[model samples]
Target chain A: MTGYLVRRTGQMVLTLFLIITFTFFLVQAQPGDYASFYVLNPDLPPEVKDQIRAAFGLDKPAWQQYLIHLKNTFTGNLGVSFGNFPRPVLDVLVERVPRTLVLFLTATAVSFYIGFFLGKAMAWRRGGLFEYATTISGALLFTAFTPAFGLMMIWAFAFKLGWFPVGKFLDPLVWRGADVSANYVFGNMLLSAAAFIAFALLVMLCLKRFGRRVPSVAAFPIVLGGALIIVAAWALSGIGGLALDIVKHMVLPVATLTLISFAGTMLLTRNSMLETIREDYVMAARAKGLPDKLVRDRHAARNAMLPIVTSLVYSLIFAIDGSVIIESVFSWPGTGLTLLQAVRSEDLPLVMGAMLFIGMLSLLAHVIVDVLYVYLDPRIRYQ
Target chain B: MTDRHDPLLKVDGLSLSYQTRLGEVQAVRNVSFELARGSALGLVGESGCGKTSIANCLMRLLPDNARLSAGRVLLDGQDILPLAEEDMRLLRWRRISMVFQAAMNVLDPVYRVGRQIIEAIETHGVESTDTAARERVARLFRMVGLDPQLMERYPHEFSGGMRQRAVIAMALSCDPDLMIADEPITALDVIVQDRILRELKAIQQQLDMSIIYISHDIAVVAEVTDVVGVMYAGRLVEMGDTSDVFRAPAHPYTAALMSSFPSVSGERRPLTGLPGEPPNLSDLPQGCPFHPRCAYATDVCRTQYPPQARYGSHWAVCWHPLDATMAVQS
Candidate 1:
């Protein structure tokens, strides 16, 4: 474990270096000059414009300017925003980071859970009517015109039906008071405590009923009930309303993204599972009088999940990028939307910051997947 | 030992065919055999002689394309051909099991060896507790002469011979009455094969389980089985008590197989190979499937497929039997 952590840490450092260097070069490559905005101001004198340029070290050569920018970045300053915002770029990003995380993480967890189980169901009952319908509908939903599909969903569900509050952040006053910092801290703590209690209760219940012989018919409903209770409790505190609103807003995008992602995951998993069933070990499992479910779960699915795990982890990077379009269509205030706006305005610092964030996320996901691979597949470990 | 009891398995007029793009291929044609309780019967044949197909039919593990054209496989007097999948699964591993040839690759590499075996045990409601299952697994490992500590290791960690033993241990986990070992030792080295065969013989004696041992090697079958059935072109050409058939072989195919292998204790002679390849099942000859390959084929042999003719307890399917005069000419 130490060796693996050391190797991963080394890789992380290398990844950070590469991302920072690339961001530096790419940001400098933008066409518009940083001082051009100040230059456009008629009231500003020539001396003041030159002083402003000299203050940020923009008057130096591009390479020298890049070095100064890197130095300021390492010193916890992301220079200043080009949009005339007084706050440093890093502070502004930090303020928006939590909201972006709330949206992205919710969408990710919800879509993944729904897609994975739905795919499993389709694969299990492969040739049935439900499976055929899911396959066809999933195909059409995720077609090249997914953004258009998102628009149609908004038109039908949000605009015409008015089932959900259309495209805007919720009023903070509904969940918290005027003092944003105190409200944020207090709400986070209460939610965390509630989540902890709920999780503890769940674990205790699962442990208590671990070996009980429950009827199969009652199993799914019981589990679902437990999950609902946990989710309800976790979303009970301040920002919970905001989180709920976010989830409601996320539904169409999540469903749209899941539709696109599910096609490949479903196809790959079904094929792999079918192939695994034909393997000699599956026959051995049967010859040992193992029940079909046990054989499939313990023997077949465990081994077959190796390829899917890799694909799922690798696809996360693509998913992150894909969310850019989804965020734009849904008008969600996420890093994806921020990055898009930054790109349009050619805000180098903001765009580079977003890119750096994405690059790190991709790297982190890859590291996690590599470690999981070793756990899921024994052959790699000893080999 | 000679108590009168009905055979554990009776396969009557079993014929299997596959509907391929070319045509229907009669893989196993009119094969019949009986395996008594606590006895081993060997089905010896060359490659493509329908040996594996017969095994598949017995287990009802045939692919979608293959059809059981005609047959009734009775397991202890119960017809298995028309049994539901669930019922068949209940009988499988608990009453009837099969050990395939490639035993090493048969294990799930992701799980621990003991966990895989425990999964099998628990699936059949053999043991419930982890401790009890571990104990049972340990006993099984000891039975197969493997260390129980190795249970935590994955499949890839073990050697080929050990993996085969592990598979056999898993097969015996349910204590099935009939174990079909389909060329179990064919993929192993000669020394390992000898060890496995001996181990199988000992296990058979201890458990008193009937075994249907399929192989292509005549001498290996002779060493392990009490009754040997020689197959040619999907048909059982000859079958009888091992010594009775070996001492005075009545079938020409059996004579050819015996002559092809170099005997450990026999006079040296020119090695004789079978005349022609086994005929393609889809385009088999009308008169006899083996007539094209048989050296002693006559006009009658070319026109009519011979029926099994009984000589004492032994049976031979031939138009012309090898007499003393005919043996000299051959």
Candidate 2:
């Protein structure tokens, strides 16, 4: 397993390198460079324009610039954003990537879990009311154009019902009075929870070493302690006022992403499960007198999960990539928004940087999925 | 000394049909049989002759569209048809279990052989502890002539014969009173088939459990089963002791079935194939299901359904049932 991991990691690194180089050339090949904005300016002199060109390294050969860009990327330097002028590409991305991650990660997780269980349940007793309703609705949502869906949701919930914020990640009016120290307190609380869990594990190991059966609820104290810490942090931070604002602003975008993505997840899970439940092993499980639920869950779902697992990993990348259009639609600040801004202004450096980050993330997701796939599917040999 | 009052399994007038898009298919029609304790009965038939359907009905594991329209499947004199789903589950795998057809693919490919068997043991609420259930699984693997160490391997890693043995071991996990084996060895080669049959017979004798072995092979049925029922077009056409039925088949279908195979003692008689296909259940012929394919089928046979003709201990569903006197004359 270690050998397989090592080999796969090596392959991932090589693939990422190839992808970065390819994207860099492609983005550079676009009609105009970032320095053209100065060239087109009426107030600029010929020497000033040449100096501006030299400043951005436009005078260098494309190959030389690409080699330098590669070196800089390897050395953790993503260069400067021509669109946001003089700001480092790393700094721009650092500010925006986390927001996208937070938004889409929540959306992805909620959709996957809900879709997975719902799909399994629907297929277990297929041709029933629930199956028919869910499958038809899932198909409709899956086939619906995403941006249009987002717009329709905004129109219905935000405009018509006037329940949620139309767009944005924060409500400035509510933020003015609310305490922002909740994030700090929450981080500390999480750290203490981790420490408690480690202590609990240690105690369990000690009990096992002394030849005692560790109680099943031995970690209950740690869990309770963690809950108390979180509650204390919640109280101390005065976050209730801030939470409503955040949740209100978050509703439209999150709902849009979840509604669109979950349909695919549901359909994938349903189709896979439907095929699996008909397998001879599932019949054998039923013949063994396993309960209906047990036959579906243990025998059917576990086998059906191979396709779902693969889709889940790819969906993670899709969720992140989809933030490009979603953030644009919602006017949210994220890596996708930054990439859009970079492309519109023809900022080659920033575009390449964003592409590299996405490429790396996709590579990482693939590697993780490959490892998990090997573990889940017995037929998949490491070699 | 077989008594009607105390049979372990009494399947009476068990009729099942599937509600298909075209119409209701009469998959099994009024099939009746009784299995005594510590004995093995084989239901031999061609594909789709309602043999597997009977096994499924015995397990109450029918598909969604299929319904047990009329039947009383009594285990230990308690009718199981009226039992709630929950109660039926409790009876399944504990009182009665099944070894499904295509044993090569019966065990889940993703799970270990041991895990799959232990699931059967644990799900029945027998030996709830993981360790205890696992030990039982290991013991079962050894019981079925497989190495306990190889129990951890996945289905693909094991040979076809070994997988079939693993399936048998799983069926035998709960030590149920009756085991319904539905064409268990059909997917295996002749060599592996014989080995599994011998092992199965040995286990049956040692465990002293009743068995309803369903198969298409007459030789295989005769090898392990004491009593045999020959099914044709969704009905048991003839049923008696294995030796008796093979020696002098009472029904025309059974005669055709037996003669289809070559006998070592007899001269090389011309091999004759039973003509035509089994009648479609949805649009069956008006009278006898087998009349179109039977050589002795006459006007009476084509126009009227045959009633059960009893000859001492044996019975056949035929108007002109063959007998020992007729066999001697022929």
Candidate 3:
């Protein structure tokens, strides 16, 4: 298993290298660089335009610039963003990526919960009205156009109902004269979510170590406690109102993403679930006298989760690309939106940096899914 | 009847069908049988003759589309058919566990073999503590000729024969009174099949419990079973002591099965195949299900289903029961 992980990590690095090489050349191969407009401007003198080209390092040939780019990338120098001039691309990303993550992660987690829950029930109680309704609706949600659906979600829940902000990431009124930036709060939200997950995992591990009866029963309280801690910490913080404003702004986008993406999970889960319920192990489990619930959940649904887990991770990374559309639709200023604007303005450094980030994120997620499969499915550990 | 043993399981007129696109399939039809305590009964038949349906009915593990239609499964004088789902669950694996075919890979691939067995033991409250349950599993592993350490390994880690043995150990985890092994070794190699059969017979005797094995292989059944039942088209055609049925098969289907098998005692007969395929379950032949394939099938056989006929202690459903004098080298 360790050997497999090592090999997978090597493959991932190799894959990331290839992706970076291709993306750098492809984005560079475009008609012009970030200084193209300034270089073309007749209003500016030739020397001044040359200085502009030299300033952004576009005066060098593509090959020399490629070598420098390679060296800088290897040394973790993403360079300064021309679009957000005077700001380092990494800092810009650091400020924005977490918001996308905060939005994306919440949406993914919520959808997974709803999808998996409904999926198991729909599969278990097949050939019923609930099954039909969930199946049809899930398919519709999955097939629906994201922008239109986002608009509808905004139209109904935000515009008409006025339950949430119509657009953007935060209320400027809440942030005025505030000590902290929205970026700071977004970073903390992501950190708190990670910490909670780690805490839950630790509790699960301890429960597993001590053994049965109380593990499942005890996990509930521990998780609830962990959640309570996160909530309490957030409530007591100075940026509590700022965070609330961001959350209120988040409702429309998050709800839209959740609604649109949940169908993919639900449909996959339902199909996987249907296949597993017919498995021989399910019958054997029942014959072993396991209760209806245990047989369905432990033996059947547990096996069904293998594909869903891998799909979930891949789609989360995959959703990064989709989220460009999402971030634009709701005017959410995440990295997806930034990446898009950078591309439009030919902000070469920001574009390349954002592309590399997205690429690396997907590659890492793939490895995580592969590694996770080795644990979730014992059969894969051998390979 | 030769010093009748007490019956541990009495399945009376049990009927079962499955709802399919083609319409209802009468999978098991009026199948009635009694399995004695401390005995191994083998139900032998062709692939689609409802052998597994019978086993499933006894285990109450039928699929959603399947309908019992009518039946009574009396386990130790308790009519288990009408028992509540929860009550049946309590009785299953605790009182009457089942072993599925080895080819089915019945063990959950994610769980360790030992953990799976321990789950069965745990589910039925067979052991007071997890430690004691592990001990029981270890003992069962030993009984089935598996290393206790191998229990920690996942199902995919075990060989087909080892997995079958693991399945056997799982079936015996709760020390149930009755066990139904449905084509348990059909997927195993010849050597493994022999070893599993020997271990199964030994376990049945050692534990003094009843075992019901459903198989299409007559020789395999003969090696492990004390009594044998021959089924045709979802109906038990012939049944009696294994030796009696093998020697004086009264039903033509039974005769065909006996003749098709290699026999050391009987005079050598050319291996003759039963002429036609088994009838489709949805639309069975009007009379005895085996008539279309029975060489001795008469007009009465085609017109009406046969009544029970006796050939010494063995009974068969046939219009023209084979004479005892014609027994395999009596």
Candidate 4:
């Protein structure tokens, strides 16, 4: 295990180095740098243009600048953003990341929960109205154009119904009274959600270790408690208004992402579950005299989860890559949106940072998926 | 003597069919038999000959497409055919459990072997406590010649024979009155098959339980079963005491099947194959389903379905009996 971890860490570092070098050179090779804004200005004199170019490091040779970039990135100095000057690239990315995390991670979690649940239902007692309806609708939704859907969602929910904000991450009006930043609240929400998940897993671990079932009813109180705890913590910290504002702003995009992505997981789960139910073990489980519920959940659905879990982990890692279209459509300030802006304005520092982050996360996701595979599926454990 | 008043199980006129795309596949037709309290019965036939269908029907574990056209499965005089799913669930594993075909795949690979068996035990509420249920599983593992410590291992970790034994241990978890072992050891090697059959025979005697061992191999079943029923193309062609049927072998199909196998202890003889395939259930011949394959098939065999004809204590559904004195009386 130690060897595996060490090997994966080395691979991740190498891959990130390649990503940093590749994106850095690609953005550097663009026709002009960020200082071209000043050079193109008729009002600016040649000497002033040269000063601006030097300040932005565009006056140096491409190879010379590449060396500085490699050293800074390696030393964790992502450098200052030319577009959002005076602020380091790391600070800007850190601010935008939690918002993207809060949005896409929530969507992924919600979609998976719905998908796995409904997919199991569809496969267990197939040919039902519920199964057909969901399958038909899920397939259509899965293939639907995300941009058009996101726009329709904004039009219907925001423009027509006057529900939720039209765009952006937070309402300046609410934040005027509250001193807390929206990013701080989004960060806290992610932490609290993570805590609740850890707690739920701990509860399940205890129950499973004892060979006791985690009764369905028992989950309700724990979930209710987790919600209450999160709410109380946010309210007591006096940033409930700020958190609510961010949530309100997130509604349209999150809803759109969830609905579209829900179909993918649902259909994948349904197909995988269909195959799993036909496995001889499922028949053996039934012959074991397990009631319909236990047989479906324990024997069939759990086995069906292998492929879905793999798909989910890879998708979640790409969530760090962020959705350019989703973020742009909503005008949400996230890594994807910022990456787009940086690329357009030739902000090499910011774009390289985003690419390196995604590359590192992608490798980490592979490691995580492999570890989970060994844990969830014993057949692969030996191999 | 068998208990006429209350046999362990009485499957009366049990017929089952599946509604497939090709129309109704009559998998099992009017198959009836009674199992005594402490004896093992073996149902042997060629593949796709309704042997498995009978096992599934007895456990009430047929697929969604299957229809139990007619039957009364009486366990302790209680007809279980009309029982609701909820009621049948309670009856299953507590009354009639099954170790399915290819016992290697019977265990879910994700769960530990002991947990899967414990699930069977806990489902029936057989044990008072979880620890007791686990202990029962440990005892069962030991009973089936598996180490109790190995119970925590997954199905993939165990060898093919070990998996079969684990499945056997699981079937015995609730100690049902009758255990239907459908091709239980067919997937294992010859050496493991002999060991498992021996263990199974010992377990049946030690627990005083009835078992219906279903197999296509007549030789394997003959060794472990007290009574043997031979089926062909969805019908029970012959049934009698194992020794009686093995020795006399009245039906031509039975005689062919017997000769198909090389007997280990008997005098040396060349093995013979029963030519032609078992007729498709949906598109069977006009008369006796096995007549096309039977060497002694005649005009009477082709014109009418044969009913059960007795020859002393043994009964066979055949137009002609091999024994010279047995007249064709149904």
The top-ranked prediction according to TM-score is 4
Instruction: Give the C-alpha miss distance for residue B218 in model 1, angstroms.
Output: 1.8
lDDT score, candidate 4, position B220: 88
User: DockQ of every model listed?
Assistant: 0.67, 0.71, 0.75, 0.83
DockQ of 1: 0.67
What candidate 4 gets wrong by more than 4 Å, as runs, is A210-216, B1-5, B326-330
lDDT of 2 by residue, B1-330 (tens): 435448888899999999999999998999998888999999998888999988888878888899888989988888988889888888888988888887777889898888888877877778867788888988998999999988889999999899988888988999999998888898888888888899999999999999999988777888899999999878898898888787778898998887777765668898777789877888889788898898888999988998876655567888777774543211
Looking at candidate 2, what is the lDDT of residue B26?
92
Which portions of model 3 show Cα errors greater than 4 Å? A1-10, A39-43, B1-6, B264-268, B324-330
Put the candidates in DockQ order, highest first. Answer: 4, 3, 2, 1
Q: Candidate 4 lDDT, tens digit per residue, B226-315?
A: 989999989899998999998988999989999999998999999999899878899999778888888898999998997788776679
lDDT of 4 at A68: 91
Could you tally the backbone clashes for each prediction? 1, 0, 0, 0
i-RMSD of model 4 (Å, 1 decimal): 0.9
Residues B104-195 of candidate 1: C-alpha lDDT, one tens digit per residue:
78888887888777776766777777678889888889988899998999999999888888888887877788888988987888899899
Shift of residue A162 alpha carbon in model 4, Å:
0.8
In model 1, the runs with Cα more than 4 Å from the true position are: A72-84, A98-135, A171-243, B1-4, B323-330
Best-matching candidate per DockQ: 4
Candidates 1 and 3 compared by TM-score, better number: 3
Query: In model 3 chain B, where is the ten-residue run with the lowest total lDDT?
Result: B321-330
Better of 2 and 4 by TM-score: 4
Clashing pairs in 1: A281-B106
The alpha-carbon deviation from the true structure for residue B325 of candidate 4, after best TM-score superposition, in angstroms, is 1.1
- Model 2 scores a TM of 0.90
